[model samples]
Target chain A: MSLESVVAQSHVIVCCGSGGVGKTTTAAVIALHAALQGRKTVVVTIDPARRLADALGLDGLTNEPAQIPGLPEGSGEMWAMMLDTKATFDGLVRRYAADSNQTEQILENSFYRNISTSLSGTQEYMASEKLYELAIESDYDLVVVDTPPTRNALDFLEAPRRLAKFLDHRIYKVLMLPTRGIVKAVNVAAQTLLRSISKVVGTEVIADAIAFFGAFEGMEQGFKERAAEVDSLLSQPDTAFILIASPHADTMAEAQFFAARLRELKITVRALIINRMQPSFGDNHSPEDLAERYAGTPLGEQYQCLAEAQHLARGEQKHLLGLAQELAPAPVVQVPVQAFEVSNMATLQMLGQAMFDTDVTSEP
Target chain B: MDPKQFLTTSGVIIVAGKGGVGKTAVSAALAMASSSVGLRTLIVEVEGKSGLASLFNSAQFSYSEIQLVEPSLGVGEVRARTVLPEDALLDYLKDHGLKRISGRLVSTGALDVVATAVPGISDILVLGKIKQLERSREFDLIIVDAPAAGHAITFLRSASGLEDAVKVGPINSQAKDVLALLNDPTRCRVLLVTSPEETPVNELIETAYSLEDEVGVSLGPVVVNGVLPELPGLQANPLEAAAQAGVELQPSEAQNLADAALFRLQRTALQRAQLDRMAQELPLPQLLLPYVFTSELGPDGLAQLSNGLLAKIRDLPDPSRS
Candidate 1:
């Protein structure tokens, strides 16, 4: 159940959680740890925060995987990339189009230009597409994906099926057939109907739609096949999901909800990572006794603060315990709140080591 | 204007921040503060997280507004509700005499397609619902716990995006109205919330700039939540203090106290640096909320936060208006 073993065993590791819970940092640290252990690793991040680049000591990240420098000589290669949804979609169009002319037509279509990038779940879909592409085409031993914050994380998991459904849906095909000569026999009636629709939806908008779908006509099959491949890859035994969260009540609730949804999707959650845990005081003198012993002294105020900190720590422990009971049989790892943010390789290395040392499973 | 006056005058106040930055807690606190001052308040959550209900110690909230905290001083009442885009779409269709077809649309997945194909359509729907409620004048204030910072800018700009896409239509016209309401400083304001941390602070600054430059929304004060209190007269090292005081302690106890003090001092220093950055970079009013040590931030905790917020507001320069 150790993180090292998990990284060694799973080809695909998906880091998911609610927002602002250190998911990006966790994913980067895990990727670094895997690489340091001599596994070629690439961390793909969909986080808009740009923290991954900072953690990896890169000036910036792009859609292409850039190998990070300054690792130990014997360590495996580490690469990082940020998911650019628009670029990924454009790449897909370029790859699947019948010809460069068709690609030009599709790219120039207003509806395609807008929807390809700004669609609600388009980022999730593109992330899945990129991950699938990397898994099949790249030489990396492990691919770690940091997904978008909660709720959207589910969208990431469901993106392939959703895209496939959209492509195969009958209405879209019907709308495009008028432009593809497939309905030439009934062209007159369809033209009249389209005219009325265009009048309502604006003629230019309808034209753009028709052109976009027309350009996509022959590519639907390829899109669906790729979507299915991504779907299968995600559900395979070699892929694992990690649910990350802090011990805050809302975060823990969200993590649990996501875990349940992942279970419903038949995706096994390999581990639960609770980050920013309160620093434990261990079995030292109780805060209450310390408070009494130091009462009326100048240090009493300090004792009070210590007592409050301990109380908060205990509260966090309670929540962590509750989460453990709720997610029984899933190994839990607790990471204490660091005094400084994990911004560079040195801090990330320390964090990775801390994470490695804290992989204790709850009693079943 | 002071925070209280800003809250009273603006019809819609959006509480936005990075996720897990206590936006919900701040929104609830603001609503309670408004309600206590006798302004009819409605706190709305659009993320479908039902966080407001939990903050209020309730089980769940439907799309319809329900009374959450009764108003004091006979001003008005406080209510809470959850709004989802799907529900808004159904409501919109029902209002347009397509009630029967709405269910069909949902069942056949046509609604999902429409929501997806049109960028920001869901956001427009949610904002459209809020606009409708604001026009109804049922509440004096509507506090929205908007999406996290990155998506929030998109959510706020949905109206303009729709307006640009559909130049002329009922939807476009509605977007125009929403845009006008959002741009009017007297009608709408955005309060950026951030925990005293590097990531959240950085996000707050970026989001604040975008809110102004992209959406044309007026920015209000920034609420810095979970700030650590400075323990006055404490030395840099507590162990050194204890040694100077000639106090005897076991190794474990000494180590525990020293660790605790060091952690607090480090956090306090970090918080100060972050706050200074906010003040230097943003140039907006800032309010600090101390870190609450409670295990659960239930209704009582929210009330305490509300009082703290009110105290901070009172300390600001009073508004010139009546």
Candidate 2:
């Protein structure tokens, strides 16, 4: 498939792999290629390496969409944002709330803000909702996302369902412990637990939780509905997931495991980009020939280093082939190891070239 | 360095310290040495830095157990990869080549990425992988180039996060197995690496207490990198002379001599003060690495570091013996 073909067809490109495998860089390159092809693209990176800025030659960026410079002004625009987990969570709460008053109450309530933003996996839910909004709005022709490195990276893909389940659950209403009159003997289990917690902690923290739940009482379904909408948008044909990995066994295993999970989940596995790949000079020199030629040679030391490097490269290539065999056998691109580290856009463009500039169909 | 002493009951050795304190370099050196001695070793990190890769001169590495070097050594760099529920099912099927007949099952929600993108998710997976590596016994040593001080506790504490999320199931069972390995003192140890700077020193001390209090991981040795050695036999005399000469010295040859002496005095004083502070704060034994100013810490440099620091560590009697 040509770069244009993938860009034109794939709607959602999800980059995943082991950390330090250049997932963020790969995402930026694909997005940039899409934009250059006259498709509006937005790249959202969850990588803290902040290499996305380097890929775009941007010094820094905020959570909001910032237009990348140096691309032709009118042809296509590439907008990038580093995912700010907390701010995104806050934004989601505000955006999905029924009205300004409810939004204000949720925002002002410490318990709501803490559980919504600081609680583990909250950011993942927000990121899911945010992407769903962008995908549905059709503001960009394509959206490229960089996922957090976690075993849950696969589970993260299931976040909308989990969030929706929690939103739809009756636990919050039960936790509210609505005060009943003296005539009716209501279930005081929640009230007793709240008082017990206060006694143990010497504070009325449970009161804060109750207040937060009260504000969120009526609008929980709104959140659940958005979660449902997102759940549907993710599996659409327009969406494609790119599995990024390095030429390491552990990374390949992760890619394979992720690919397997994707198969199980039914996400479109579009293509695999093996980042920071080592180049194989090929097996033109047999081991016996290499040994005999270097036996009495004056360049023995240099030969040894070259032979060792060649050996390492071959090992990496073997591992990459194994991953390909394990996956869907789509277009596999290998980005050769650069002499210099990727710290700026020039290098990233070279990386993009390594990824997108290849003869598209040559499977690794 | 004595490999025997190093591998005594091989478990997990997490190297943590302030950012840029040579923790990565030290972890790589230790892992390399461990592997050289016929021990299966794995090094892990959260940030996708190929700090260890550059040392080994390898370009591609992974998050699962892939050997970057020959024989017994491996490295896993855990970067998050999202598989939407539907897509995950499809990926599973496609690996089985099920995409040919049934491809409609893929879930397209962005929720997977959104939910897993939380701050501690990376930390949780990172530590979980490290814990997994530690348990395999495929490697005698599991060296973790842990995140900087601020997040080290959370990285280790991610076990709790996973446990909370998975109340019951195979994932919960896996979490239990990993947590068992983590809590075993013989199976794991946390090594704090620090420089002789104020911020890193304070952070190291704070991290030590937090990890102990929050995660219950015992703090190991504090490896102080880039430590300046004292000028032998050139101590109080020069400093006293400088202090006595309150009258500013003129720009002369003697002034340069006095200035060099004063520089040595100041550095020695600073080094002593740093060691003293660490002594008061941390109960663990401290290891010191001499300053090497060059930017690159390649293979040869790493070997040299392993030899030098391990030699110093060997020379010191174990506090247990004392």
| Best lDDT among the predictions, by candidate number | 1
Residue B148 lDDT, candidate 1, scale 0-100: 77
**What tens digits encode model 1's per-residue C-alpha lDDT throughout B220-305?**
88999888778752443556656655676677776777777778788888889999988999999898887887656877778888
Q: How do all models score by TM-score?
A: 0.92, 0.60
- Candidate 1 residue spans exceeding 4 A from truth: A174-203, A283-297, A360-364, B1-4, B71-75, B93-97, B233-248
Which regions in candidate 2 have their CA more than 4 angstroms from the true location?
A2-4, A48-51, A72-75, A167-169, A177-203, A287-298, A359-361, B1-13, B16-322
Instruction: Tell me the whole-model lDDT of each prediction, alpha carbons only.
Output: 0.79, 0.61
Candidate 1 per-residue C-alpha lDDT over A190-258 given as tens digits, one digit per residue, 9 for 90 to 100: 445445444433566666665666677788888888888888999888898888998787788877878
DockQ of 2: 0.03
Worst 10 residues of 1 chain B by lDDT: B232-241
- Best-matching candidate per TM-score: 1
